[model samples]
Target: MKFISWNVNGLRAVVKKDFAEIFQKLDADFFCIQETKMQEGQLKLDLPGYRQYFNYAERKGYSGTAIFAKDEPLTVSYGIQAPEFDHEGRAITLEYPNFYLVTSYVPNSGAKLKRLDFRMGWDKAFHAYLNQLDSHKPVILCGDLNVAHHEIDLKNPQSNHHNAGFTDEERQSFTKLLDQGFMDTFRHFYPDKEDIYSWWSYRFHSRDRNAGWRIDYFVTSKRLADHISDSKILTDIFGSDHCPVELLTNTL
Candidate 1:
C-alpha cells in the first residue's frame, strides 16, 4: 500500500495552493498530514473515498495532525495518552488489522533552544509510547519530527549545529528512537544521498537554493523494513515550507 505524509504547515493555506490537485494525483491508500493548524468545521476537504481523522490543538491555529485513509481503521486514537502533550493535538494513531499508523508533529526545540527541556521530555515519553505500540504489532509512524538526525540530513550542518533542530540533544533523541528498532525509511533507501530535504526556511531564498532540512520522516518498526518498497522525498511540491515524504510498503 502507499502511504504519504506531509507537513502542510497550514491546511487552510495549502488548500488554495494546488493541494487539491496534488491530493487527487497522489491517490494514496493513506494520506497523513501534520501541522494542520485548524480545528474541525473551520474547513472541509472533499477527499472522496477517504475517511478522515483529525486532532486539533486546544490553542487556536497551532499544532495539529490529521489523517485521510481510503480504508477505515479498526480504532482511532487522538494522542499517546500523555495529557500534558495531548493538549497540543500533536498526535494521532490509527489502528489497522496489521499495524498501527501514527502521525505526529513533534515539538520543536524553539529558538535558542528555549524549549529544549520540554522537547526532551516529549521525546522520552514518545519513545516509550512507540515501544509500547511495537510490543503489540509493527508501527508505521510519520510526520515532521522537527529534528535533523544527522549532519547529512541538513544542508548547513556546521552553522545549524546549535540551532533548534540540529542541537545535540535533539539529534540524540532521534538516535535513541532509531536504536529502539525504528527504521527511518528514507535513510534506509538513500543512506548517502545529500541535498534532498523536506522542510526549508522561508527566509534566505532557502527553497531556491535547496537549503533545506529533512526533518520529516516515515519510520516503521525494524521488522517491517524488509517490506519497504520505496521511501522518497517529494521536495518539488510546495504549498508550505515543508514538502511531502512517501513510503510504499507491503506490510500495510
Candidate 2:
C-alpha cells in the first residue's frame, strides 16, 4: 500500500495551494499529515474514500496531526501516555489488522536550544511508546521527526552542528531509535544519496535553492523492512516549506 507523510506547514494554507490536486495525484492508501496548525472546525477536507482522524493542540493554530486512511482502522488512539504530550496533539496512532501506524509532529528543540531538554525528554518517552506498540505488533512511524539523523541527512553538517534540529544530542536520539530495532526506510533504500531533504528553512530562499533537511521520515520496525517497496522524497511539490515523503510497503 502507498503510505505518504507530509508536514503541510498549515492545513488551511495548503488547501489554497492546490493541495487537492496533489492529494488526488498521490492517491495514497494511507495519508498522514503533521503540523496542521488548526483546530476542530477550522477547516474541513472532503476526501471521500478515506477515514479521517485528527488530533488538535489545545492552543489554536499550533501543532497538530491527522490521518486519512483508505481502510478504517480497528482502533484509533491519541498520544502515547502523557496528558501533557497529548495536549499538544503531536501524535495519532491508528491500529489496523496487521500493524499500528503512528503519525507524529515531533516537537522542535527551538532555534536557540531553549527546548532542548524538553526535546530530549520527548525522545525518550516517544521511543518507549514505540517499543510498547512494537511489543504488540510492528509499528510504522511517519511524519516530520524534526531532526536530521546524521551529517548525511542535512545539507551543511558542520554549520548546523549546534542548531536545534542538527545537534549531536538530537541526532543521537534518532540513532538510539534505529538501534532499538527501527529502520529509516529512505536511508535503507538510498544510503549513499546526498542533498535530498524534506523540510527547508523559510528564510534565505532555502527551498528554492534546495538547501534543506531530511527531518521528515518513514520509519518502521526492523522486522517490516523486508516489505518496504519504495521510499521517495517529493521535492518538486510546492505548498509548505516541507515536501511530502512516501513509503510503499506490503505490510500496510
Candidate 3:
C-alpha cells in the first residue's frame, strides 16, 4: 500500500493550482492533508474511488485536516481526544482492522514563541493519543508535525536554532515521542541523506535555494518498520510550500 501526506497550506487555494493534476498523478491508497484552512461547506471536491473525511476547525479559514482514501476505513475519528486541543481540527484518525492511520497539522509555536507553552502541551497530548492508538494496533502517522527533529532536517540550522520549529523544546518533545516506540520512517531509510527537505519559506527564495525543513513526515510504530518499503520526500512535485511525503509498504 502507498500513503502520501502533504501540508497543502490551504486546500481551497491549492485546488486552483494544479492540485487536481497532482492528486490524480499520485494515486495513493491513502492521501492525508494538513492545514486545509477551510470550514465545512466551503468547498466540495469531486474525487471518484476515494472516501473523503475532513475535520474542519471551529474557526473558519484556520487549521484543519482531511484524508482521502481509496479503501473505506472501519471507523473514522477526529481530534486527539483532548477537548482543549481539539478545537483546531488538527487531527484525523482512520481505524482499520490491522492498523490506525493518523494525520495532524501540529500547532506552530508562533512568531516569537508566544504559543510555545501551548505547543508543548499539545506535544504531550498528541503523543499520548498516538500511544493509546498504538496500544490497540500499529499506527501509520503522517502530516506536518511542525518540527525539524535534527540539524540534518533543515538548512541553516545554526542560524535557526531558536526559531519556532527548530527550538530545543520542540525538538526534544519530538525526540521523546519517537523514543516511545515510534520510528521516523525517512531517517530509518536514509540516516545520512542530506540537503533534502519538505517545506520551504516563501520569503528569500527559500525553495529555489533548497533552504528548507523536513517538517512533513511519515512516522510509524516501531513494530511496523519491516513492513515499510520506502519513505520519500517528493520535492519535485509542488503546489504548496510543503511537498508531499510518501510511504510505501508491503500490504500493511
Candidate 4:
C-alpha cells in the first residue's frame, strides 16, 4: 500500500495550486494532510474512491488535519488525549484492520521559545498516547512533527542550535520517542543523505538554496520496520513551504 503526507499549509489556498492534480497522480491508498488552516464548509475535496475525514480547529483559519483513504477505517479519532490540546485540531488517527494510522501537525515551539514549555508537555502526552496505541497494534505515524530530530536531519545545524524547532530539548523529545520503540522510516533508509528537507523558510530564498528543516516524517513502530519498502521526500512538489513525504509498504 502507498501512503502520502503533506502539510498543505492552507488547504483552501493549495486547491488553486492544483494540489488535487498531484494527489490524483500520486494515487496513494491512504493520504494524510496537515496545517489545513480552515474549518468545515470553507472547502471541499471530491476525491473518488476515498473516505474523507477531517478535524478542524475550534478557532478559524488555524491548525487542522485530515485523512483520505480508499478503504474505510473501523474507527477514526481526532486530536490527542488531552481535551485542551484537542482544541487546536492538530491530529487525526484512523484505526484500520491491521494498524492505526496517525497523522499529526505537532504544535510549533514558536520563534521566541515562548511555547516551548507547552510543546514539551505536548510531547510527553503525545508519546504516552502513541505508547497506548502501540500496545493494541502497530502504528504508522506521519506528518509535520515540527522538530529536526538530529544534526543529520537539517542543514546548518550549528546555526540553528537555539532555534525553536531545532532546539536541543525538542530534538531530545524526538529521540525519546524513537527510544520508546518508534522508527523514523526515512532515516532508516537514507541516514547519510543531507540538505534534503521538507519545510523551508519563506524568507531569503530558502527553498531555492535548499536551506530547510526536515520536520516532516513517516514513522512506524519498530516491529514494522521491515515492512517499510520505501520512504521519499517529494521536494519537487510545490504549494506550501513544505512538500509531501511518502511511504510505500506491501504490509499496509
Using TM-score as the measure, which candidate wins?
Answer: 3
Point out where model 4 deviates above 4 Å.
none
- Give candidates' CA RMSD values in order: 0.8, 0.9, 0.6, 0.8
Write down the TM-score of every candidate: 0.98, 0.98, 0.99, 0.98
Top lDDT hit = 3
Where does candidate 1 clash, by residue pair?
none
Candidate-wise lDDT, in order: 0.93, 0.93, 0.96, 0.93
Q: What does candidate 1's lDDT look like per residue over 172-202, in tens digits?
A: 8899899999988999989999999999999
Which ten contiguous residues of candidate 3 have the minimum total lDDT? 34-43
TM-score of 3: 0.99
Show pairs that collide, candidate 4: none
Question: Candidate 3 or 4, higher lDDT?
Answer: 3
Which segments of candidate 3 are over 4 A away from where they belong? none
> Alpha carbon lDDT of residue 112, candidate 4?
89
Off by over 4 Å in 2: none
Query: Using alpha carbons, what is the TM-score of model 4?
Result: 0.98
Candidate 2 minimal-lDDT segment of 10 residues: 79-88
lDDT tens per residue, model 3, 12-37: 99999999999999999999999999
